[model samples]
Target: MSAALVWFRRDLRDHDHAALYHALKAHTQVYCAFVFDRAILDALPSRRDRRVEFIHASLIELDAALRARGGGLIVRHADAREAIPPLALELGASAVYANHDYEPAALARDDAVRGALGAAGLAFHTFKDQVIFEKSEVLTGAGKPFSVFTPYRNAWRKALTPFHLKAYPVERYAAHLAAPPAASIPSLAELGFAPSNLAELKLPCGMRGARQLFDDFRQRIADYGRARDFPAVKGVSYLSIHLRFGTISIRELARFAQEQANEGAEVWLNELIWRDFYQQVLWYRPDVVTQSFRSEYDAVQWEEGEAAERLFAAWCEARTGYPIVDAAMRQLNQTGWMHNRLRMVVASFLTKDLGIHWLRGERYFADTLNDYDLAANNGGWQWAASTGCDAQPWFRIFNPVTQSQRFDAQGRFIRRYLPELADLPDKLIHEPWLMSAIDQSAYRCTLGRDYPKPIVDHAAARERTLARFKAVRPTGD
Candidate 1:
């Protein structure tokens, strides 16, 4: 009776799970397990990390679901490199299965785990589950990886088929799920983590939560393009965190998007394609994990220490005196998320306006965002900072005030997050300090005191950023 271990990593759900489905089909008996992986956790700055809390809750839900199928998830709080091989030997499993993780660190860790398992005489198998198209799949006509998105997206759509959207029929092999000797899930405190403050935030957890959110988004899918920019509106699908962990199926989401490819669905699908493009970028150009995507951009000088710190603190704390920028930061600090447009706004402010290194802002977002993925987060930061392949030109720096006025015409999103700016009239809220003395007095706010004045004048910073780019830019062009 050959037994197989299904090692759950980011793919936390039971339905349509590629690795689990393969394991159940090939083996007579199967066991499932999840490791808390201290190698990853100890690096995290906070004990109350919301991503941890979300994973913990998802694991509990997974354990419960497995129990209903006459099996249980063996939860452990150790490094995967040490935990998996020994557990495979102990259970006499012939093989172990898992989904691919494209992050450089994860790829290295998986290699080590596979080597260890092979040394212990166990087969290690991996499947591509997280993405529809990956490294070299949707390439240029010349067979090179695409650095541009439009051609890549077109190639992706042309290559996608029903097979790509087919759900793995895990339920068909449910009988193979072994009735493992029962083990209990460790409590958050027991595993060296405390309950997160996210409890009050009521973030949806697990497969059930993902489904509920997806259903709600379907009703408003048409308005996604228009609404996703507004922080106060439910324009964007909050499915990013779910997509990050694979608590939800990418196939289902993509299939749904394909079915609805109206103006809204098409916009949403483009975002998903961007998600895949970034993953493939990370897979093919793993150096992007630490360095700029466009090497030439690295020559640009950055302001560091006291000045950078002051600007970063203002950006993070949502006191940048630019309402849209402030609102975006407040959303991230308060809820661990931000609208996509605001991500661009804040990143431009950091890289172009403050003249700080893009890496610093990228790391800050990594620390704060619940939906942070290595590839997408890094790609976004690089794109905003003009340091990535196909990045926005450095000279085209966003005017934060104009961005606010254009996106939040009524200042509804800004007022919701920055209460101090709430009383300012619609026209003046975006740049309250720019208002006349009479308007400023009526609003009961002053630039230097009530809100910090703009850290750097935009026009001056724009010229400075442009000149810096020119210094390193290609001499011929």
Candidate 2:
């Protein structure tokens, strides 16, 4: 009957989906399915994970969307490497279709699935749906993959055409979609998870939620350039979670950014290009998953022993005594999202100020962020550590007080998470430790009692960090 199975992964939405579109176009009967892969879910540190909850909520919407179009999602909760091939065979499908995933672990899973499907005489097909430009799509003048972002972004801009931004017209072949089953999706408990605060958080789920956020952000996109850096303002698009999960398409976002022709939109578009940049890096140098991108940076001696462990615990618990860093960590713990600006600040504080390793912070973010994409998160931590392509300079440390004053001045964002420091005047909020003992008594806040004192002085730490990096700096530069 020329049947094909469409396997949904990170791209959860129904419309304009690359694999679904292609599957429908080529088959007389196309069935869609989503597996809550146990390999990923079981490895999570907490069962109350917001990302898992987000995916669960999104699948409900996706299932409904497909049902409305004469198809529904075949939901399964199992190891995908063991589940997909048999399911495709049971459905009498000759091929399995999916979108590409670039993470080395994900790539390995795909390879396993492909091999199993091939042994069963079923072809496995994958398409590029996540990014507009993938590995080798945009390159240097000599056709080498770009290590630096600016030149790559310029090339990405020059390579952009209307075709790349065009959506896949899935509606064209919807008639071929097979009818859906009449079963409801599994509950959170059924999936071995507890209810998360995902609904309470402003981070919406599913295609409808994605559209809502995008529509609102569209109205304010002109202000994005000046507004994104400030955590207190609603200046940036809160659509990152949507972008990470493919509830919204990259083409749609990029297309709008290109049309705006404004500085704000252009800057946002560059950020989108950065997604592709990291993706290609992961594709080319999977070794970066462990080793530093610049091998020289790997030679530096990171702080070790009980003291380093204590520092990491404080950073994780939001007890760093640096207001901005602690506030940012608080935000990440309470909610699964952090502001991009704060992400950089916290990463800098963790690696540079505390002199801990970047991998530890990267792993922490991997467990925490609702929109955690491997490529972006890894690239970001590496950038902050100054050990990645086009990373921040190793000597350039972020002063936690300065970052707080600059981005959260007036203490609006800091107050939101660290309410204990709420009573301090805006002038004293960024560095409350600066207050005299009498002033602390007056404000009803104490330095060491109410709030922990700064664990390491930023100035002293900066000098030590410089010396550590200097020991490993390449001879020429």
Candidate 3:
């Protein structure tokens, strides 16, 4: 009986998984495994990281799911490159299969693992599971990679076919799952990581958790475009972490959106496309991980040291004094997620209003956000700071006040996150400082004491931002 191994990476689910499907098809006895991946985990800042807890919870669920099918996930506590090939050799598997991971470090790790497997006369196969369109699949007519989103999105939509959205019926092939009944998944502490405070975080964790969130979002998806920007409303699908880890299939979500594209289904569908778009951007241009996509925008000088530290501390602690920005930051600090619109508002506030570096904000998000993916986070940061390919026009800065008024009109979002501002009248919630001193006293809040004064004057900052943008912009235009 020929045996094979499926090395699970970001794609954690058993259903509709490309690598699992391929492995089952090619081999009669299939061993499944997941590595705790110390190479990645050790580098993370916190042991109590929510993402780690989320993955640990998901893995527990996955092991049970596999056990029901007469198999179980052989969870490990080593670096993948070191662990996978050795396991394949011990099991005498002909090949190891996994889904693609486009991050540079992941790619390097995979290459090393492949080499080790090759030395042991084992083949390594990988399939695309995390994204709909990857690498250069949706290039422009000129055969170059797309920098602009709309054209790329259109091309992506056009390229979609039945085959792309088809789910791999893993259940039909379940009999082949290796019956390693004696193999048991280790407890989280055995992996040298402590249990996190994530149970209190209220985030959905596994396949079942992902589905529950999806079902709720499906009902509200039609209003996603209208409601996603408003933080107080439960308008956006909170499936980002699920999608990031592959607890849910991209095909399933894309198919759901594609089928309902008419009555504003396109709005939700567009977000899915944005996910793919950023992935492809990262795949083709890995340099975007650190440097600017458009090189010239890198010339814009950034504030540094104590000044930046203070500004960043203010931004992170929700003390930026721009009510919307503060509220959004509070949401992120408390919940590990931020609404997309506020992501834009706060990012613009940091880079343009405060003249801070995009990378600083990007790093902060990377550290804080549970749903953070390298591509999406980087793409968002670059777009806000006007340093990415087809990024927002440098001159078109977002005014924080107008943005707040437009998106969170009733101060519902602000009040929810900024409880200090909760008692203020709706008229004063967006800009608490504008209220008279008597009103401020009545509201029981004072700028610079109870809250913060605006870090930078919007008008003065906007002029400075405009001048800075013009300084580095293409001379002819």
Candidate maximizing TM-score: 2
Q: How close is candidate 3 to the true structure, as a TM-score?
A: 0.97
lDDT tens readout by residue for model 1, 1-477: 889999999899999999999999999899999999999888888888889999999999998888788778998899999999999998999999999898988988999999999898899999999999888788889988888889889999999999999999999998899877768888889878898767898889998889989999999999987788776677889999999999999999999999985899999999999999998888889988778898887888888888788888887787777778888888888888888889999999989988988898899889989989999999999999888977998779999999998888899998888887779888788878777778768888777877777778899999999988999987664
Q: Quantify all predictions' global Cα lDDT against the true fold.
A: 0.89, 0.92, 0.89
Give lDDT tens digits, candidate 3, residues 1-477: 899999998888889999999999878999999998989888888766788888889998998898899778988888888999999888889999999999898999999999999998999999999999899889999998899999999999899998999999999889999866466667667766677667777788999999999998888888887777777788889899999999999999999988885655788888889988998889888998989999887788787889888988888788889999999998888778888899999999999998899998999999989988999999999999999977988888999999999888899989888888889988888888787889879999887788787888899988988888888888774
Rank by TM-score, descending? 2, 1, 3
| Residue 354, candidate 2: alpha-carbon lDDT | 91
Q: In candidate 2, what are the lDDT values of residues 197-228, reduced to their tens digit?
A: 87787667899999999999999999999999
- TM-score for all predictions? 0.98, 0.99, 0.97
lDDT score of residue 251 within candidate 2: 92
Return the TM-score for candidate 1, rounded to 2 decimals. 0.98
Looking at model 2, which ten-residue stretch has the lowest summed lDDT?
178-187
